[model samples]
Each structure stands twice: as C-alpha cells, then as structure tokens.
Target: MPPQQALAIARAFLPKRPWGNRYDYYYTRAKLRTDPLYPGVLAALRDTPGPVLDLGCGLGLLAHALHVDGQPRAYYGVDIDASKIERARQIARRTGLKDARFEVVDLGARWPEHTGNVAILDMLQYLPSQVQAGMLAHVSRMLAPGNKLVIRSALGDDSGRGRTSKVTDLMAHFAGWMQEVPKSYPTRESLEGHLANAGLSATFSPLYGNTPFNNWLIVAERRAG
Candidate 1:
C-alpha cells in the first residue's frame, strides 16, 4: 500500500477528538510521515506468514498499520507499558481488529509463548547488552526454520548520523520517554555476530527517514540445518 493511503487508514484509528488528544494523534501522524521504517516494515512482512509477534509494541502502531494495509494476519503485540497496552486495546476495539491482541509483559522476565515471524524495532537498545543477547538467542530458538526476524536499531558508528542518533536518544531519556537507556549502543559488528551465533544470516541496510538518525534494519532469516 502507498504510504499516504496507509497513513490515512492509520490515522483513522486514532482518537476522534482533534484537540483533546492532540499529542498522540500528531505524534502518530508525524511518525508515519517522517519514519521510513514503517513502510520498510510493511514491505518486509508482505510475504511472511501470519501470527506476527511484535515485541516492544508501543501503542500497537505496527499492528494498526498492518490492519490498515489490508494484511489480515493475526497480530500479537507485547509491550512493557501498561498504559500503552491499554491504548492499544482501545484502538483495536475502535478499529474492529478482531485478530489483534495486546498485552503488557516485561520482556526481561521471559519470552512470551509465540510461533511466527518476529519484529523487534526501535526497542532493543533499551536493554542491557547481555539482555539483548539473551533475547536474540531466545528469538533464534523460537524461530523455526525459514521464518524471518526483522530488527531495526541505531547501531553505534562513528559517522555523523550515529552521533546524531546518540544525542537524540539522550534527549529521549531526559524527557522520560525511555526509562532504561543503556550505557552503550550495539555496534554493527556486535549485532551481526549475535545474529550469526543464533544461526540466522542477516543483511543490513540503512533506514534513513526524514529525521537525522543512524537507523539500520537487519533482516535475518533462519536457515534450515
């Protein structure tokens, strides 16, 4: 689906009042406009099978986007924020998403029981390095042969974009948007190694949106032994 059309459908799912909840509405709209990751995510899931597991799914934006794009697959979104999960549920009801489910679960506690293509976007960096590695390992185990795992993160690079991303992340931290900002961001090498050790071959590509950030996506597919 075209980005504008998809975004229109997405906005339809937002709160009805134009002035009351302006922040959420405008934030969602702006994200759809500026963030190219949303479109990339849709493209990645186009051919993948159903029952998508979305980790760190804030306000269930991806779930709503998929529904708007006419993907009728069953979606399960897990996030640590209770309020976000509640809003996600409300959106699902308001939009009549019968196949979608949202829940508040601490990712560090354990992996939710699921089997399908996985999407971890813009959330892994909040975890410590060890936790990140452990989650990746668990995802590797949960992924059956031939399934895909799509991960988007700001890799630690020395380039201008990388530095910009770091500063923005710090601002996010100070704003209380992100609670657990790690001391270090994952480098491309370390991220690739983690995936490789999990027996998943990953290809990297830059995901530059209208914003200046060093966002990159890793599309990893599990190979049959």
Candidate 2:
C-alpha cells in the first residue's frame, strides 16, 4: 500500500476515545506502509472466491485492505483478543465497510463455522507444534474446489533471518503485543508435509519485502477432480 493510502486506512481506525487513538493510528499506518503481509495476501486472494475467513485477524486490517482495494468479499475476521475484536467491529461500523464482521474466538479450542477462502497470517508460531499441525489439517479440509488457503508465517530455519524473526517475536511477547511467546515454528518440510497429508497442493514464496523477518507466503488449493 502507498503511504497516502495507508494513511487513509489508518484514519478510519481512529478511536473516539482520546487515550489510545494515537497508538492505533500510528501502528496501523506503520503496519500498512511497511509490512508486505497485506499486499501479498491481497494478491493471493484476488482470484479466489468469497467469503474469506481470516483466522487471527488483528484489528481487521485485512478487512480494511480488502475494502480499500475494492474486493467486495464478505470478510469474517476472528481473533482471540476481545478488545481487538471490539475495536475492529467499531472500525468497520464507523467506516461503513460492507460485508465485514469481527468476532473473538480461541482458535486452539474451536474454529467458527466457515466455508470459503481462509487466511492465517503471522500467527501459526504461537501455537504448539501439534496444535499447528492440527489447525493446518482442519483449515486444509475446509477448502472446497476453487477456494484457497493463504498463510504467511516465519518458517523455521538455521539462518540469521530466522533467528531475527525469533528474537522479534520474543520482543513482541515481552511488550505485551502477543499473549504468548512463540511456542514453535514450522519448517518448510513440515508445513508442506502437513498440507500434502491434508490433500492440498501448496506453493511457497518469500514475503519479506522490506522487513527483516523470515516470512514466507504459502498458498494452497485442492486438486481438481
């Protein structure tokens, strides 16, 4: 997203309260401008069908990005944080973003009933390895023909970039930006094996545009009959 467009989107998230509005504004702006996550996701989802189920959606930034990009898919964003969910709802309602909804749900315990494309971004490392495998299997099973499962995660590796990602994630946990320290990161082989076992073919590519984190974009779809 361009700086001006990111600024415009950030303005929509401005809270009515005086205390934390600045944080929301700047954080949203910075994430939008600097992070390549949204652009990568938006491109991956462009040809897929609606609606989209975004697991671990923080403050519904994807919803806003879709709205800005003129993708009219019905977006259902869920996260474990109640406060962020409420704030996302507020932003959607205030901005009149059609077909966007937000909810709070513990993904480790249960996933909402959804049938469409799915997005899991920057969240898989927080769960235990078994949970991550289970979640990937569940998510892969939800994919119908022509639908897609898009994910952005830091793949586990021995490289310096991988170490940087781990350190940054730890700092996020310490700063209270995340509820848990990252438990496990899935290696490329593990992720591919899990998805292959679930009957989906996947493609992986580097998503680290300007950021130093070891992020990779994985797009999976069911094989055609």
Candidate 3:
C-alpha cells in the first residue's frame, strides 16, 4: 500500500479536532505525510517477527500507522509525557486497537522488559549523555538474534543542516513541548560504536527526506551467535 493510504487510515483512528487543539491533528498529518521516518520504520519492522517495543513513543503514532497497514505485530509504546500517553490511550480506545498499548514511562529510571523490534525515534537527543548510553545498553541486552533496534535521530555535525535540527529542537523545548532540552546529538560513528558494543551490526541511511534536518536512521540487528 502507498504511504498516503496508510497515513489516511492512521488519521482515521484519531479523533477529529477541527477547532480545539487542531494543531496536533495538522501536525500529525504533516508529519505522517512528509516525514520519511514513518515509512522507514515500517520497512524496518517488516521482517522482524516479534512485538515492537517503542521507547519514547509520542502519541503512539507509529502504532496507529502499523495497525492501519494491517501489521499484526503487537505494539507497546512508552513515553515520558503523560499527556501524549493519554492521547495515545484515547485513540486506542476509540479505535479499538487492542494490539497497541501506551504508557507513561521514565526510560532513564527503568526500561520495560520486552523482546522483539524496538524503535527510538527523535527521542534520544532529549536524554542526558550518560542516560543515553545506559538506555542503549539496556535495549541491546533485550534483543536476541534476529531482533532489530531502529533508531532515528539527528546527527551532531558542525554544519548548516545540523544547526537547523538543533534550532528546531531548541524551539520545541522552549515551547514546552519537549520535556528536557537536548543535551547532545551523536555522530554516526559514535552511534555505530554504541550499537557494536551492544552486539549489533548497524546499517545507516540518510532519512532527512525533503527537510533540512540532519536526521538519520540506524537499523541495528543482532545476529545469531
């Protein structure tokens, strides 16, 4: 199915807010339509035959898209934002997407116990440097052979595109949308090193789409010993 159709179906699961909080709906549509990350995520999970544990999942948008696309993998999404979790739960309840679950979770304190495909999308930058490594370590241990961990994050480069992403993140933080200010972004090499330390092989790709953000997707898979 084309991404547009999948996105349309996903939006159908969300409540209509033509007047109140309309920005969320508009943002959702624009994101699902323009951001390459959503399609990239679906492709990453296509062959991974297990439940998806999404860390820092915002509004469980990916879960909705998966459900719309008829992917049968059960989904468990965790985020630190209570409001987003509530919104996700409401969508699930309204749409009757029983396979999807969302919860308010502090990833720094405790990681959920699950094994399968994992996703950390546009979220790692919000974590402190130490917590980011620890979280990566925990996720690595959770995966067995054939399990993949997909991460989409902006790269830290001293370039114009890098600055663009950084500025956007800062604005988001200032607007109170992001709970914590982004402390740092990892270089591709550094991220790969982290994946290697976790016993995973990484495949990196530019996922900026038509945007100027220095975003990349790292699909790290644990191989059989």
Candidate 4:
C-alpha cells in the first residue's frame, strides 16, 4: 500500500486514543480504513448526481475519497462531536479537499436536513428506535423517489418466537455502543420489512464472516414520488 493508505490501515486498529470522545474517534477511523466494503461504497456513491450527505460521518475519509475521484460536487459530513470534526477538518486540509465540509451536530437530536444522496453507515442503531424510524420517514419526505439510501446496520434474528427473540436481545444487550443495531442479525425478512415500512423497495447484500460482527447492506430506493 502507499504511504497514506498504509498509515490509514495502521491507524484503523489503534486502540482508541483519549484525544476525541468515543464515537467521534471510532467513527472517524471507520471513515478512513475501517470500512472493508470501500469498493461497494465507492460504487454506490460514484453515480450519485447530488451533494452527498454522510450522516454521522466521522473523520470524513469516505467523503474525501469520493471528492478525490471528482465525483460528488459537494460532500458534507455531520457528526455529534466537535473534536472529531476538527480531526476531519485537518484531513480535508491536508488532502486539499475543497468540496467537502463537516458540521458538529447530534443528528439523533434532530433529523438531518439534506437532500439528494445520503449515507448512514452503521449509524442507524446509534439512534433510539423511534429516531431510527423517524429519520427514515423524514428522509422519505426529503428525498425524491429516485434517490437511494445505503444503510449498513446489524441484523436481529427474530425467526421462531421466543428463542430467537431472546438471542437477539442478548446480542443487542452485549453489543454496547453496537446495541442500537437491530438484533435481528441480518435476516432478509426483517431488513426487507424495515425498507418496506420506510416506503422503499430494497435489495440486500449479505456481508458476513471475517468481520467483527454480522452486517447487512441495504440499498434501497424511495418507493413513492
């Protein structure tokens, strides 16, 4: 790997330093090299024709990469921590990225206000249940029908009555910060329902094994005009 990429890979696994608060530090790093699905992420964003809003964007690496490819006209990252935002700013400046921007805001405190393309990577679970649904519904209102939402979240397995539910709940309880992730554990039926409820038609990609936890990538398009 090249020097910067090498640094990013090295930094990816560093025990979280005490510099920034928890989410900011981790999310920032995730934006850099933590996301192993960058090929898919790049493919999803490459064709988007509007300004991209990376909700809960940590260090802005995803957005920065998109900008370097000369794809998005503008890429904006909003996070709940200012320390991470400062770190993101530094990354932008060092890379000489101009079309990207970062904002300090707790999106869970309120729905993010942005139109066109959107990305919420492993951030849905961070919001309370109602907030997760509300954010999707809110985005439903903001984005046109042709727009897409790429969501990466944990799946809860609610297969057979009490047994699965208990297991799912146990997973959530132990997931800590990851608890917000739906404990369904990547079942198509459950994920499809979430998309259907949000007024989207969805297709899913199963990403499992060799990763920290089970995850599903939902690529959904708004169903109503």
Q: In TM-score terms, which candidate is top?
A: 2
- Report the lDDT tens digits of candidate 2 across residue range 106-181: 8878877788899999988878888888887888777878999999999999998899999999998899977867
lDDT, candidate 3, 1-225, per-residue tens? 365765574565445755546555666777787889888988888887888999999888888778766688789999989988988888777777888898889886888888788999999887776777788888988787788899999999898999999999999989987777887788877787777777788899999789999999999887558
lDDT of 4 by residue, 65-107 (tens): 5654556567788887687688787767656677788998877
TM-score of 2: 0.96
* Residue lDDT tens for model 1, 70-145: 7788889998889878988987888788898998888877778888889998888777777788888888876766
Summed over model 1, clashes come to: 0
- Clash-forming residue pairs, model 4: 28-59, 155-184, 155-185, 155-186, 156-183, 156-184, 156-185, 157-184, 157-185
Worst 10 residues of 1 by lDDT: 1-10
After superposition, candidate 4 runs with Cα above 4 Å error: 1-34, 158-191
- TM-score between candidate 1 and the true structure: 0.92
Each prediction's RMSD to truth: 1.9, 1.3, 1.9, 5.7
Error of 2 at 20 (Å): 4.7
In lDDT terms, which candidate is top?
Answer: 2
lDDT of 1: 0.81
Candidate lDDT (C-alpha), each? 0.81, 0.89, 0.83, 0.63
Error of 4 at 208 (Å): 2.9
Q: Which of 2 and 3 is ahead in TM-score?
A: 2
